[model samples]
Target: MNFFIKLQDKISEFKLQINYMKKFPKIVFIGSTNFSLFSLKELYMKQYNIVGVITSPDNPIHKNEKYFSPVKKYALENNIPFLQPGNLLDDTFLKNLKAWNADIQIVVSFKILPKKVWDLPKMGSFNLHASLLPQYRGAAPINWVIINGENKTGLTTFFIEEKIDSGKILFQKEIEIGKEETAGELEYKLKKMSGSMIIKTLEKIMKKQIKPIDQKNINSLKYAPKISTKNCRIQWDDPSIESIYNKIRGLSPHPAAWTLLFFHKKKFVRFKIFVVKKILKKHSIPIGLIFNISSSEMRISVKEGFISIIEGQIEGKKRMNIKNLINGIKIRKNLFVR
Candidate 1:
């Protein structure tokens, strides 16, 4: 009786393995950043057939210091095949990619793919974009949405096309932006949600449950161009407290909203504001004036209000809260920000 029971258990385990192998299509994942790792992990944990991976080449952050992309590291640890092609249109890269014979490809947080690469898979390729279709369509959608004071944004999965982010949409899921959420915070939220969305998209595609739809009336859509140093500068003269608030948070913890500190026409230093709270009330002081510099608080006067610096970093110092930052700086009456 014991022998027969063990045999039955072995049979069940074999059947499970067989089902896992037969159900999922062959996949070749393409991604680079930590944002892309979430979806790849989900697919891996679900026992999907990952045939290959394509990611950006190792890039040097400092002289003679190069690091592997998140996707490449994962592929290496799992003993899965991978390629890091500098040019997507390279003939040798194309040959190796075609040899994988993937049933489908999934792109997440990766560079633009040429038509040849995107059209290679039998079931074609789909991309998991960070924003909903026909809106926030560009390189920095997550940052732009928050900077524009938008209360809602979401994710979209679409088929790859020649045009950037203009392909037929496969699925979309909307999320409400928090009242005081920073871009980094919102990105973290969306990153966690993206894993499940990628899985659902793949299942629906495998089951023939999705009907791709073309984007409509995109001529008037808002764009999310890459953030530049000029764009990150804090425009203190802007009348709206909300606009300045949004701009600061939208670029927080990365390409942060910055301002030049001045001590009576002498350039003092530059500071990057990360977290802030707006105080709205009637005020006669000139905008960009730094007042209330105390051991416990630091406030910058703005239009009809003051922007209380909750967290910030000096140009050459580490990030600190308002209290710590204030404690380190010398109290001066003539200090102001531009």
Candidate 2:
């Protein structure tokens, strides 16, 4: 009877292994940013079968230093398969990708995929976008959402399509934008939220419980194109203090909002503003005029209000608070920001 019991236990274990294999689908992940890193780690923790990762080619950290994308770094650390293809349409890359026999592909913060690549998976490919579908749909959704002073934004997982970000929505979770939240802060919050949402989406997809909705049916569609250098320049002449404040926060801490600081006639300095607050009390000072240069505070006047520069950096200097900046730099009498 002991021998029979041992044999039965072995057979039960074999059956359990078979069940697990059948339950988990072969998944391929495509991404390159911190957002992608979080999702990939979450999937691994949840025991998903991630067969391969496709990310952007390694770029130089400096003139000679090299750096791999966050997704590539994770894959290397975990010994998972990864590919960095310059062109997704390459026949050899396609063949190798097909060899994985992935049931589905999950894309996050990656470049736009070709149809041949996106359609390789037996089930279908999906993307995790950083904003609600049909609104803020483009490369710089996160920055634009905050720049536009949106009170509410969210993440959306959608079916891949030929057009950018205009895909069938699979799942969505709304996120609130704080009054003073910077784009960098919102990015962290969204990145953390994306992992669980993607897992939930996959579970529903596998269980045949999800129904993708067409984006065309959604209202209030707004496009968020890539941010340009010109776009990052703050227009102090604009009367809307609130809009200027939003622009400052939207681009804060990275590719920050900039303005011209005139120190001498026909010569000026470029100042990148990282943090500012709207002074509700109206001021009659001319727009873009700088005053009140103290150890801890500097104020620049706008149309109807003043923008207190809480944090900023000179073009060739390190970022610093107003106190440090004032202590180190001289305050010229004719200095003004435009």
User: For this target, which candidate reaches the highest lDDT against the unseen true structure?
Assistant: 1
Q: lDDT per residue, candidate 1, 1-338, as tens digits? A: 99999999999999997687645588999999999999999888878899999999999999989999999999999888999999999999999999988999999999889899999988999999999888988888999999999999999999999999999999999999998999999999999999999999998998899999998875779988889999999999998999999999999989899999874346678889999999998889889998888877778999979999999998889999988888777656777899
**In model 2, how many backbone clashes occur?**
0
Clashing pairs in 2: none
Question: Cα lDDT of model 1 overall?
Answer: 0.91
Estimate the TM-score of every prediction.
0.93, 0.92
Please report how far candidate 2 places residue 140 from its true position, in Å.
1.0
How well does candidate 1 score on lDDT at residue 27?
Answer: 95
Model 2 lDDT at residue 254: 81
Q: Which regions of candidate 2 are displaced past 4 Å?
A: 1-23, 218-220, 264-266
- Positional deviation of 318 in candidate 2, in angstroms? 0.7
User: Residues 70-96, candidate 2, lDDT per residue (tens digit)?
Assistant: 899899999999989999999999999
Write down the lDDT that model 2 would get. Answer: 0.89
